[model samples]
Structure formats: structure tokens, C-alpha cells
Target: MNAHDRHPMTVPSEKRTAISSLWLWLGGALLVLGIFFRVYNLDYKVFWIDEANTVLRSLGYVSQDVTDTLLTGELFQAEDLQAFQQPSPDRGWDDTMTALRSSAEHTPLYFLLSRLWVQTVGSSIATWRMPAVFFSLLLLPAVFWWGWELFGSKLSAGLATVLVALSPLHVLYAQEARPYSLLALMTALSSATLLWTLRSPTWNRWLLYGFTIVVGLYSQLLFTLVAIAHALYILASELTIYKRFTPNLLRYLIVSLGCIVAFSPWLVLLVNNLAEVQRKTASLGDDRYSIGGLIDRWFRVLNQMLIDRELAGWNFLLLLLAIAALVYLWRQAPRHATWMLLLVGGVPFLALALPDLVLGGERSLRVRYLFPTVLALQLTLGYWFAATIPTKRIPQSIVQTILILFIGLQILSNTVNAQRLVWWNKSRPASTYFEPVSALVNTLPNPLILTESKVSDLLALSYWLRPDITLQAIPDVVTLEIPQGYDPIYLHNGTPETEATLQQQGIRLTPIYPVNDSVDPWLWQLEFPL
Candidate 1:
């Protein structure tokens, strides 16, 4: 018999090669699916409050309807406001940067890119979401490489790519014209480099890491947590290896100093606007971050990862899996399982939770804040399924089954999120941004639309609606004078509060009546005797 036939090495080698090819093919297929989902229904959801901010900020157009704060006269030029009869033209680059620096949160990286993007693509709703879609698609391959570097398993890397591609929350952010996708991509890149750097701290890698941190901070302030997480991981690892201070220990210290020097501009800006940051945080979510609150939020994020729903009882299962994965990594690959595990999976979450718990901030409750850590957790799970259990000599089919279950859950979660966005009335998942008033705008003659919202909100709507009808948010109706030959209509935002507030202010109306109007942007319309 021939040597090849006697040993049967050729057939087994062929089988292994075939399996590897299949894994690669599967990964490619999943990447395509993820890109399709990103592009699908790009202009589906209406510009909610947050999305409206993105549009206005991108346009650099100050709305005539600036929110009337009680202290506006003291702190801002409410009277000197720049109101545009038409959607304001693009403010020059410098002005755009200046406006964003003062008015909107975060540094101007994403918004600046978005402005230039809209200038080229045209600022239609569908076109606006394209940048985020690109970022989301970009993340698939990025995550694959990052996971590969950490776990050293082609299967784990491919699976991590698949998981990120199908992640419902990531998909939702990907469809929006927001900075989270950009931030996610940056952090993922930083994470991949950080993992490589941990293995061997070289000068080129340190410079790249510092550069990424600068870009990430420019993208979003939350990225600082990622930097801190890396620092802690390096410290812990060095302590374990050397157990005392040495020249090698100074390597990370130098990286920190480099970041400090590079990020000085944003650091100064951050300090100057601390109060504004606090206000924005308070506006974002509940500010309680106690031990109990942290536990609740941890589970909430895990829930978002696993089920993408708000229902309870799934937290325990998630916690158990996390423990099992950690224990397995600790036992099987202590070198990799120590620093990478803590940096990627532990520190970012704790960074947010600890600060919020002590300082009582608003970010702890938000899922987006923990994005870096969330990805780490996902990566760890991928390693667990691909390496840990299989390393223990478990049946390959069981491991494959676990992988299938995870993918299935992710797909189902995407389906659930899709249905919610498509059908939810509050979200108004429609093509045109002005769908809320589409029927009313063309039908009503010379209609003066009144809202209790800020001028910015009305300006955003005006951006979508034609400049034929007038939109205003007058807080005080008593001083309001009705223009001659115009029908006055008040769109109620889910309550008779507008009418009640009018009565409370002793503003006698010319038969201010509420009609169940389905065509108007608001459900309740108060027709007044003007």
C-alpha cells in the first residue's frame, strides 16, 4: 500500500481543510447579512428628540425655536436668536465647529464628518443614516480580527463577527445617524491593538494606542473608560509577572503620559464644560447608581445583549454563564485569561459603575455607555464556546449546539427590535420625516401650528416640512396675538395639559376646543377663537 493510503493522512487533512473553508464561508455569509440589515429600511424611524439634535447640529442651523429657559435672558441671547424662515444653509466649517462645541455634547469629530457627508450625499433621512451604516459594516471585519488576536481561534473570531453583526442594539444604533457606530468602531480598533500591545508592548503599538485613544475621545467621552480599562489590565499583568517596579513598568506610564499630552485640548474642554455634562447626564436617565442600581444595570445590559427586551428573570442565566466562562478561561489559559479578561470584560463596566455610584451620575443606567465592556463580554463568551469547553474534551457537537443557540437568540432579538421599530406609533417608523403632519399640512389652509416644545424642535420639523405653514412653541398663550386671516391650531402631545396650562395662566380663549385629530403631528388639536 502507498504511504498516504496506509496512514490515511491525506483524507483527514482534506477534511480539516474543508471544515476551515466552511467556517470562512459561513463568516462571509453572516457579514453579508449584517450589511443588508444595516442598509434595510435606512430611513424608517422618525427623527425622535435625539435624532433631531443630530440633524440640527449637523446642519449648523440654529432653529428660531430655541427652548425658552427661565434664565435664557441671563445666560443666552433668547432675543438675539437667529431664526431662519427656511432650513438654514450649511454654516461654514469654523462656525459649525464653534456651534457644536458650545451647544451640543461631545467633541466635533462625528458631527463634522456627518456635515461633510450630508453636503455630498444630500441630507435626506435615508442618506443621513448611511454613515452609521458604513461604520456598522466596518465593525464586522474589525471584530473578527480583534477576536482572533485575543482568542487565537478562527472559529471564535468568526463567531464574534457574527454576533456583532446580528446584535439588535448595535443594529439599531447602526441605523441611526449618531456617533455610537463611529465610537464603537474606534473602540474596537483600540481594543484589538490593546490586546496585541499586552502580548508585547512595543513603541509602534504604544503610539498607535495613544492615537486611537485621542480619536476615541474625540468621538465620545465614554472612550476614556476604555483607556483606563487597558491601563488597569497592564498594571495587573505586570504585577503578576514581575511583582515589583522595574524599567518595563514605566512603559505603560509613558503611554499614559503620551495620551495626557495628546488629549490636552479635549481635557481642557471637558473641564470647562463639566456643569453642562452633568446637566446633559441628568437629562439622559435616572441618576441613581448604588450597588443595587449597578446590579440592575449590569443585568439590563446583559438582557439587551441576550434578549434585547426589558423583561426580567434572564439575568441569573447570564450571570451563571459569565462565571462559567471566567472560571474556564482562568483554568485553561491563565496568561490570556488574566489581563485580557479583566481589561475587556471587567474594567470598563466597573469604571462607569463606580464613578456613578459615588458621584450619582446619569450614565450608569444607559446601555450605550458600557459598549466597550459589552463587546468584551461577548468576545469572552465566544472564547468560552470555541476554546474552553472544547479544550476540556467535550463533544464537538455540544459546542456547535451552543454556538447555534447564541446565533438563534441574536437573530430572534433582531426580529423583535425590527417589529418594534416598524410598528411602534411613538417611533412613527415612516419614510418622510414630516409624516406626522403630512395629511394636515397640505389640507389645512394658512394653519398656524402651536406647540409647547422648544424652537429647536420646531426647527427640526421645519427642516422636514415645507415652509408654507408656520410652526411655533409659545409657552405663554396670553401674550400671543393671532395673525389676521390664519386659522390657529394647537397640537396636543398626548395630554390636555396645553389647554390646562392655558387655563392656569388665566388666558381666556376664543372657544379653545380639542378634537381627536389623527392627521396632525400631535393627537390632540386645540382650535382657538383667534
Candidate 2:
């Protein structure tokens, strides 16, 4: 009579058990759905330029190799491009390492693992993306561990697992042959380990944390921001709690230094190749967006973390929810946990975002660069929901209903994205046009593709084109020949200079695929001199 009556908010033990079971089942189901989406249309999407490069490096070839072999104004069969995509006896692991080193901005770990992955499994497009799928699947558990450690609540961990599992952006990257998913996995694991180490500064735990740091850096350079966040959290926590440097803090610094020493080889490589790295990554710093545009895109990306339908007003609502969650955490949670969350969530974002805002760059606009921020935000939201839903003030049913609606929206977004051959996340212009253009080209009786565009573009398209088609690289469009016997010839990704040269030669190009001036056409049909 007394215990239950006095605590009206305290649900009966059996009711709590039932609610917990329900959440566990829902989390399990969402996890299965996430896995299904990651592997569903693995080969359906356009293997865009970046993915093509991933495959190339995995096969122990670089962009320079493609240029040297295929882009010397030579005529090659569409099938020939597959050579660079396929692993060979001649291009061994050493060659793969060499190829990866050429692209100094790209860390070698993912590519090296990809080389091994393809060697074991055949180099099909789906197979190439499987590593990312594996990492993303692992990410669910990693995120779960992180949330559990941060909030010390099973419900919070379960909610975090469910949220990340259904994240459309994560699902999209999981299907790509890229390291972003690996980076997420590393970030989550490292974060969880950091929290675990803080709870008990055991030697083994510290060693484990150091390992995550090294692997995290290898996973992606952006992880440097994560490590910095960890260091800041350690320093701040020690100062606040002990009011002096503690042995635990000293251990963390030593472990971090060890990780830095372990990572020095790559550091040396990056430093030595600074100019090449800068040149390779110069596009990231392009003055592409105004401050307002960047802020709008940031909201859009945050919204995409869970729901990507782009419904009007959704972004602003999400921003408010995120703010409320952080405020709630700061007020309700322990100071150390709140501070850790803030540092983990805020540091990486400010590091990237400030550069873009003040110096003018698009670094923050790239969703992959902001993955740590996304994961931290998801965790924050999870903790807030877990803490709030069980309270007597807000009816549990109402909170559950809101969460269900959010999940429903994510499911809807995933359904729409799964059916698409290209999406906004595939930022390259050619990715949007490749599928339709390839379809049009395949329909012709005999087709020839001529381009003066980069060899990388041709390689990207080769994945979509039929082996029967012929591709001719016209280094100088003035030397282009209207090869006989091909009923129709298409110009692919023709440069402005190429178009001007063709115009001077009196060749008329009719826009074919896009059929609109809204975007510069990628495919054009040429009317040769009679």
C-alpha cells in the first residue's frame, strides 16, 4: 500500500520490465533493418568518382596510373577500365602501399584493409563496400557502449543504438566504399573507452584507450579532433575534481603521447607531402557557400542524421530539440558527464566550423567531416529521451509516441533513399547523371563515348557502361575522329575547351541526357561533318 502510493510516479516492477522488453525488441528490430539497408542496394548506386578511386587504390593503382595507361588519347574498350579496378598478381601489397602513399591526404589503413578484403572476396562493387558495412554494424554496438558508459542507463544505450541504426546518413555511407563508417566506429569505440578509463584508471584500460587513439587516427585524420577532445576532457575533469593534476590525468597524457609516437610515421609522411596534401584537399576549402548558406547546410546535415525528408521547418525544430537536450543534460546529469559530452560534442564541431565560418571554407559542409559531432548529438538526444520518458511529469505514452514518429520518419527516409540510384550525399555532379546517361548509351545499337574530361570520370562511368561500348580519350578534341561503324557517338563530360574546339571544327552538339539547361549537360550527341 505504502511504497506504491507514496511514489505515484514509480511504475510497478512488472510494468517497468515490460517497457524494457519492448524497447529491447524495438532496438533489435531497428538494428536488423539498418543491416538490411546497408547491404540492400550495394551495387545499385552509381560507383561515383570517389568510390572509383577507392577501388583503384584497393587494386594497387592510383590516379596517375590511370592517366598514364588509359588517358593518353588512346581508344580503350569499356571493359579495359575494369583492369584498374581488379586486383592483379603484379600489383601486390607493396604496390597497394605505394598507390596509397601517392595520395598523401588519404591515410593508408582503410585502403590497405580494402586490399586484403578484396583479395579474400572478389572485387565486385558490393564486395568492395562490405568492409564499410561491417564497420557500420560494429558501430551500433560501439555507440551502445558509449551511451551506456556516458549515461549509465541501459535505456539510454538502447535508444542510442536504435537512433544510429536508423540514421539515413550512416546508412548511406555504410553502402559506400569509403572509410567514413570506419571513422565512426573508431570514434564511438574511442569515446566509450575514454569514459571507461575515466571510471577506473586501470593499466589495461589505459592501454586499450591508447590503442583506440592510434587506430582512430589511422581511420581518419579528423580523429585528431576527437583525441584533442579527449585530452581536453581529461584536463578539465582533473582540474575540476581534484583541483590539481592527478595520477589518472598523468596516465592519460602519457598514453596520448605514446599514441602520438605510434602515429609518427604517418605524421612524418603527411608532413613531408604537405604540398601534395594541400593540392589534393584544396577543393575542400573552396569558397562555395556564404555564411548563411553554410549555416542552412549545417541544419540540413543535422536533420539528415535522423530524418532526411527535408520537410519544411524540421531543421529548426531539430535545432531546438538538440539545444534542449544539452541544457537538460547539463542541469540534470553529473558535472563530469555533462562536461565530457559538451567537449566531445562541441570541440570537433567548433574546430571545423570556425575555420569555415571565419576563414571561408566548406570543410564543415562535408557531412563525413562532422561525424563525431553527429554521434555525440545522437548520444545527447538519447540520454535526454531516456531520462525524460520515465518521469511522471511527461506522460510516458506521449514520449513513446513522439519517439515512434521520429523512427517512422527515419524509416520513410530510408525507404526513399534505398530506391534511389543517386542522392545529394553523392556530391559529385557526375554521380547524378551517370545512371541515366549510361542507360541511354546502352540503348543505342552501337555507341562510342568520347571525352576530354579527366580519366577518373571515364573510370567512374565505366562501371555503369556495357562492355560492348567503346571509349576514346581525346586529349585534344581537335584530334577527335568520328569513328565509323558506330551508329551514335556521345561526348561525355566535355570540357568547355573541348566544346569550343568542337565548335571551331563545326561539329554540333545536342544536349541529350539532362535535356535542360539547369545543369551543364554531361552527355551530348555530336553531329559530325557529313
Candidate 3:
């Protein structure tokens, strides 16, 4: 072979420098784009049912308070429902604590922070969501720290930051008023601290890890899955290294026990109110999906971490890419690194997914529950990109192209989500119907909405409705009264019993909105016998 053919062409040092600088600039730009998306149009989407519940809880009002105030068979305006959502002089920090205790399904840390936040800033819709946005912003740095600690490479850290910054799922939760963004922040921070402690094993490092464990548990009940993953990682690591129990393992156990001791009060509360917690979350066990449906949802949620658009072919391609990334991580990364990521991601997912697959439930269908899995996947992809993109091989060009396309798709998906009033992640079953139904109701003159629906439904609908529109909420159809002088009286979320009661009164109900779907009909106009 000729000398030129034998020796492959190499890019000059200046060209390599330029490429690195370009990648750095791109990372910065993606970070800015993410920040902008997080805060942009914060109040644009439907302040969904769960968000309404969040506002009420933060304002120190429980379900009973809502029942007492709004569902008293009284004639009220739409603005009346908003009173519970606002901060008042009467409801203080103590009241918030009381409300949180009553509703033991949620942990108090996020609500307490939100109470302080809305009290400091005015309780506007955008302001209510600001804390989540702030936490999500912090998540970028936490993810960077995690990547740096795990791989000890700035390129990996930067790539991970870029991935998290452009993640559509993160952007969706960040703009929400709920605690999922805080959960994501805690997950990233805890993961990073665990890695740091593993490397150093100092007393302070162990204490820091313990602190994260406490904070994470307080953030959400699902964080227990994260703690389980961390414990498994430490146990597996020590067993692999030392072949038995050692000082490092013992220290980790002590720290873990300390974390549990610190969190015991809340744990006691949860155990005491276990029935209430179970009652509240019973909907999670509802067998809504078949095994095939669950698998479909699994893929969709997995794809949603990066892109939300339902290009079926593209989604499957991304799923394959994720599998390929995991395989690459297993082969190229250290065994411990692969094990840590797998346990962190796989354990939590399998915990939920296995139940759904074996017992037939939709517990694993929740997008918020998969936060750690999303982070692990992102880190894997980030590591793969960082390891490959700097090389001079043909695969380096392919990897670079894939990275650009992936980020570009994320931006496009996020842009689409930003413009709409609803997206896939806003998956509260009844909340999605609020926007369109409200639009229909708003067009009508002198509309009175009579709801026997849940108190949360009333509050959620109020946010979309005009203040002048009348809302009469009764406990049941037994006391249902047809108010005078309303052009058209509508029933929100009409039930069979409601229809039967109206029929007995010789009033036929006409389905207005959601004509195609009979299930959970949104609006029904009362047709009285003339």
C-alpha cells in the first residue's frame, strides 16, 4: 500500500479545538433553551386537577375544607372556587402542616416549601409553579455533578447537562405546580452524593449521603424505590470488592439506619394512616390496561423522556437506541458503573412494571414514577456520546449526527407541548376534558354549571371558566335544584343516578361536549319539559 493509504488522515489540533469549542457553545445554547421553555407560558396549560389539589394543600385547606365550603348545595360564582387556591391570613404554616397530616398520601416537604413560596410571592398560577421551575433548574447542575462524579469527565458532565436541559419530560414537570420536579432534583442530587461517598467514604460524605436520603424520602414516597436502588448498589459493590461485609458496608448500613430513624416520624404517620393512603392511591390499582396496552404505554413513557411526539416508527427507533445505549454502557463503562445505573433505573421501573405485568394494573403507567429511570437513561446516552464524539473514527460522525437529531427533536417536541393547553404527561383522567368543555361552556350566554362531581373537579374547572359563570355544587342529585334565569343549565360530569333523577323530574339531558365518547361525558344540557 502507498504511504498515504497506510497512514489515515488526522485532523489538526486547531480543528479539534474548534470542534470542542463548537460543542461547548451548543451545550450552552441548549441549556438556555431549556431554561426558557421551563418558565415560558407557565400558566398556559390547564392548571390540572392535581395542581388544584396542590394549591389547596399549600394554602392549608384539606378535602374536608373544600367539602364544607363549595359542596354545600349553595349557589356560587366560578371565582368562589378559587378562594381555596389563594393564600389567606387565616391559613398559616401550622394550618399547612395540619392539612398535610390529614392528607398523609403526600409528604410535607414540598408543600411546606410551596406554602412559603406562594406566601412570599403572590399566589398567581405562574408563581405557584415557580418552585418547580427553580428545582428543575437546579436539576441541570445536579445532573452535571452526577455525570462528573460517575465518569470523572467534564465532557460526560456537559453532555449529561445538555441532555437533561433539552429533556421534554423534565420541561413538562418543571412547569407543573406539583412536587415531581423536586423529586427529580432530589433523585439527581442523591445519586450524585451516593457516587461521591462511594469514591471517598469520608464521614462528611456519608453524612451528606444520609441527608440526601432523608430529603428524598420527604420529597415523595416513591423515593423509597431510589433508596432501595442505592442500598442494592452499595451492597453489590462491597460484595464484589471485598467478598464479604466490610467497614464500608457497615458505615453505609449505619447511615441508612440513621436516615430511616430521621424519617421515622413520617413513616409512623404513613403507617398509622395506611388505610387513607391506600384509599387515596387505590386508583393506581385500577385494571385499565391489558398487558399489551401496558407494554405500549411503557414504550411511550420511555420515549417521552427525550421526545413526546407520537411518531410510532420514530418512537420504536428511539427505544432501540436506548437499548443499544445500555448495551454500550455495559461493554464500555466499568462494571460498577453499569451496575449502579442498572439498579438505579431498572429496579424502580421493575418494581412498578412487574406488578402491572403480572397482576394487571397501571401503576407503572405513571410518567412521574419513572424519573430515576429517565435520568439513568440520559446519563447512559450522555456517556456514550461523550466517549464516541471526540474520536476520529467513522462512528464518531454517526454519533454526532444522532446527538444533533435527538436534541433537535426534543426542541421541536417541547415547542409543540408549549403551544398546546394539554399534553400527554398531564395524565389526570378527568383534567384533560376541562379545557375543551370550558371553551364550549364559555361560548354560551348565562350558563349555570351544576356539578355533583368531586370537589377537585369544581376547583379545576374554575380556573378555565369565566368568573361571572355560575357554579352550583351539591353533594348529590337528591337536592338538585334547577336555578331560575339561566339560559342553559349544564351538569358537569353527569352520572347515571343524576340522569335518572332528572328523568324522574321530566327533564331530559342532552349530551353537548364529547359527543363521541359516552364514558365520562363532560357537559350535559338540561332539557326541561316545556
Per-residue CA lDDT of candidate 3, range 185-267, in tens?
A: 99999988888777767889999999999999999988999999988888887886779988888899899999999999999
lDDT of each: 0.63, 0.83, 0.84
Winning candidate number (TM-score): 2
* Model 1: lowest-lDDT 10 consecutive positions: 1-10
**Candidate 2 lDDT over residue span 116-174, tens digit each:** 88899788989988999999999999999988777667888888888899989899999
For model 3, the stretches where C-alpha displacement exceeds 4 angstroms are 1-16, 288-290, 392-394, 440-445, 517-520
TM-score, candidate number 3: 0.94
Candidate 3, 91: how far from true, in Å?
1.3
Candidate 1 overall lDDT versus native: 0.63
Off by over 4 Å in 2: 1-15
Better model by TM-score: candidate 1 vs candidate 3: 3
Two-way lDDT contest, 1 vs 2, winner: 2
Per-residue accuracy of model 1 over 1-530 as CA lDDT, tens digit each: 00011111122455557756876897788777777777776776655545666666666643433553321222222122223321355456776666576653577788888878878866577777788888888887778878766666677777777778888778888888778888789878887777676566788887787788788878887777777776676677667666887454687688779878877876777788888776865654455566776777778767775547555775677678777767766665436444565676566677666667776764555676667866776777766776633343667787677677777777776666664433221244222335545455547766655555555444445544544655554454556543446554545232355566665755443332223344423434444434
Native-to-model Cα distance after best TM-score fit, residue 435 in candidate 3, in Å: 3.5
RMSD for all candidates, in order, please. Answer: 7.1, 4.0, 5.1
